[model samples]
Target: MSKQVMLAASAVAVLMSCTVNAATEIQWWHAMGGSLGDKVNEIAEGYNATQDQFVVKPVFKGSYPETMTGAIAAFRAKQQPHIVQVYEVGTATMMSADKAIYPVHQLMNDSKEKFDPTAFLPSVTGYYTANSGEMLSMPFNSSTPVLYYNKSMFEKAGLSDADAPKTWNDLELVATKLLASGAQCGFTTGYQSWVQLENFAARHNVAFASNDNGFGGLDTELLVNNKAFVDHISKLEQWSKTGAFKYGGRASDAASLFYSGECAMYMNSSASYAGIKENMPNTEFGVSELPYWPSVIEQPQNSIIGGASLWVLQGHPKQDYEGVAEFFSYLSSAKVQADWHQFTGYLPITQDAFELTESQNFYQENPGTRIAIEQMTAVTPTKNSKGLRLGNFVQIRDVVDEELEQVWSGKQSAQQALDAVTARSNELLKNFERVNSKS
Candidate 1:
C-alpha cells in the first residue's frame, strides 16, 4: 500500500471519531423512582448504544410535583432540559406556558420524522393533542389504574385468582371475604383522587367536565361530586369504618402498604408492575382493571392515561431543536417502544410497538401487563372519555385529595365533602380559565 492510502485511512478514523464523540447531549427530567427508574435507564442506555449522533441523559428530579417545579425553575433560570417528563395532571400547566413547549407534532415535522396522530392509542394520545389533532407531547409512560391483588392472600381467603372484580359490588363482596379471612385490610388504594374520581368518572361514561371534559375549551367545571362520585365515596367511607379498606396518604402513598403485603388488594397505576415484581416476587400478585361503579351507566368505558409524557420545551437553538427531533425519533422506534413497554408495563404508545408485542406473545405470557392495554382498548374512547385537559388541574387534584380525606377520616359525609370540593374546584377552574385566556 502507498503512504497516501495510510494517511487517508487515518483521516477517516479521526472523522468518524469526531462524529461519534461529538454526539449531541439532550437532558431529560423525570419523576420515576425505584424499579421503574431502573427500566428508564435501560431504555436510555439502549438508545445511546444504537446511536452515534445523540445522547439522552435522564435525570430523576423527584416526584411528579417536584419534577414539574424543577422543570419550571430550570426554564426560568434558562437551564431547562430539552425534554421534560410531566405527569398527566400537568398538561394544562405545560400548555399554559405557550412559548415553553415545541408541540411534539411540530418538532417531528420540522425534523422530517414520520408521525401520525391516528396511530397512537386514542386514550393516551388524545390527552396531549391539540384541537387540530397535533400531539403536543410524545406519549411515554401512559398508564391507568388497575386492581393489584395479592394472589396468595386471595387464595388463602378462598378467592379465585382468575376472577377479578368488575364492579364495585363485586369488589365489596370479595373485599368482605378477604377481611373475614383475617386480612388486615381487605383493600387499599394509591392515588385515591386519581383512580377513584378522575379515571372513575371516565369509566362510568360520566362527564368530568363540560366541553368534552375540558378538551373543547378552557372553561370546564368540576363534576366529581356528581351522583357517581357520591355513591362511590359513600361506600368507601363505610368500608373505612370496618377497617376493610385502608385510606392511604396523598400522591400514591398506599404503594408501601400494598407492596409490604399489608393489604390484600390495591388499586394503583398499571405502571406499578415493575415495583410489585421487584419487591414482592415471592408473593403471588394479580393485576386487573379498576372496578367501576355499577350504579353509574352500565358496562365499561375507557380509562385515561396517568403517567407522564415527554414534552419538548421550546425557546432553544436550532441545533438543539434538531437534536431533540433526532432523539425523539429514536424513542419512537418499534424496538425501543417494545422493550420499554415490556420492561416498565407502560402502555405501548405507538401502534407498531403494540403489534410487535402481540406478535411476540409478550402479553399472552405476562398476566398483568395486558390489563392496562385491555382497559385502554375496551372502548373507542369518546370525547367525554378521552381524558381531561383542564388548566390548573394539578391544584384541583390537591383539592380532591383534601376533600376526600375528610370523607375517609369520618370528618365529613361523602356528599358534604364532595359538594364542598365541587364548589371550591370550580373557583380554581374559573381562575385558570381567566388567566389562560389572557395568556
Candidate 2:
C-alpha cells in the first residue's frame, strides 16, 4: 500500500473516534423491570439511532420507592442521573425538592423545545400539573384501577359476563354467587389502600383528605374516616367473615389469586393487563369499570391515575437539558405514544396518541383495553377526584395498609382502623412539612 493511502486510512479512523466521543451521554434511572424494562431499553436504542449527538442510557434501579430514594441520595452527592421515574404518590416529595428538579415546563422553554401542554390528556396530566397550570414531569405510563373478572367463572356461576358488577350492591350479590359456585374466593384486590380506599373515595365523590386531597397546600389532613369510608370498610369486613371477600395481600400479591383461578374477580391497575394476558393465556377474563355505591352518589365520579412519570433532575449541564427535551419531544409523538399504550395497557398520555390507537383499531381487536381511559375521562374531575398529593405518602400508604390489615383480622373496627391511619399519617405529613418548609 502507498504511504498516502495509509495516511488517509489513519485520518478516517481518527475522525470516526472523535465522532463517537463527541456524543453527549444522558443517564435515566427507573424502576421498570421484566418486559417493561425491555421496552425502556428499546426506546433508548431508538432515540440513539435517530441521532449521534446524544445517547440516553436507561438503568433499572429496583422498585419505585427504591429508585426515588436512590435518586435523592445521588442528588445530594452531586451524582444524580439526568432523569428519574417517580410514582404518583411521591409527587409531594418531589415538588418540595424545588432546587433538586428542573420542572418540565421550564426545561422545555429554556431549551427551546416545541411542547404543547394542551396536547396531553387532562386526566393524565392533572396529577403532575402545578397549581399555576404548569406541567412538572413528562407523563409516561399513566394507569387507573379497574375491575377484572373471569368470564368463565361468571358463566359457571350463572352470571352473565356482560353483567359484571356495576355497583357495590351488585358486587356483593355476584360474590355470593361466585362463592356458591365452588370458587375458592369471590374476589380479591391488589393495592388495598389504593383501590378500596383512595379510589373508593374518589369514585364516591368524597374527599380522602382535607384541602382538596392535599393539592391545595401542605397543611392537609386525612379524612378517610368519613361515613362513606366507614360504611364501605364495615361492609367489606362483613363480607370477609362470610368468605365472600378475601384479602389477597398487598401490592399485586393478590394477583396470584386471580391467576390461580382462586378469585373470580380481581381489582388492580390497568397496567396489569399485559401480565394477566401473558400469565393466563387460556383464561377468559373481561375488564369493567370499578364498581361504585349508587346509594352514596347518584353517579360515580372519575377515577385518579396510578403509574409514574419522567422527571428531569437538576445538576445536569445545559446541553444535557437540550438533549433531554429533544428526547421528550420524540417520546410524546403520536406514533410512539400509541405503541406504548397498546403494548403496556397504560393510558396514552396525549389525546393524539389515544386517537392514533383508535385509528389503528387496536381497541376493536382488544376489548377492555379502553375501559380505563373511558373510566378516567367519564366525568370532569372535581377536587376530590383530581388525585392525592401528600408528603411521605409512600409511608402513609404503608400505614393505611397496616391499619386495614387490622380491620381484616377483626382486631379493629372500620372506624377505629381508619381513625388510627389518619392520626399516624398526619404526624408523618407534619414532619415532612416542617423539614421542607425550612428548605
Output the number of the TM-score-best candidate.
2
Lowest lDDT block of 10, candidate 1: 113-122
Taking all chains together, each candidate's TM-score versus the true structure is 0.90, 0.95
Model 1 root-mean-square deviation = 6.0
Residue 277 in model 1: lDDT: 84
Q: How accurate is candidate 1 locally (lDDT)?
A: 0.84
For model 2, name the residue pairs that clash: none
Which ten contiguous residues of candidate 2 have the minimum total lDDT? 13-22
**RMSD in Å for all candidates:** 6.0, 4.9
Write model 1 residue lDDT over 1-439, tens digit each, in one string: 6899989998897577667698777788888887778877877877778877777778999998899989999999999988999988899889877888888888889887766667777778988887677789988988888999999889878989666788888888898888888888978988887888888888888888877888887888877778777888898999999877899788778888888887889988888887788889798898888888666777889888888898988767777777778777778788888888888888898888999999999988987788888888878987767889877888788888898998888899999998988898899989988877876
* Model 2's TM-score against the true structure: 0.95
- Taken over the whole model, the C-alpha lDDT of each candidate is 0.84, 0.92
Model 2 C-alpha lDDT per residue in residues 75-180, reported as the tens digit of each score: 9999999999999999999988999999999999999999999999888898898877899999898999999999999999999866799998999999999989
Q: List candidate 2 segments past 4 Å from native.
A: 1-21
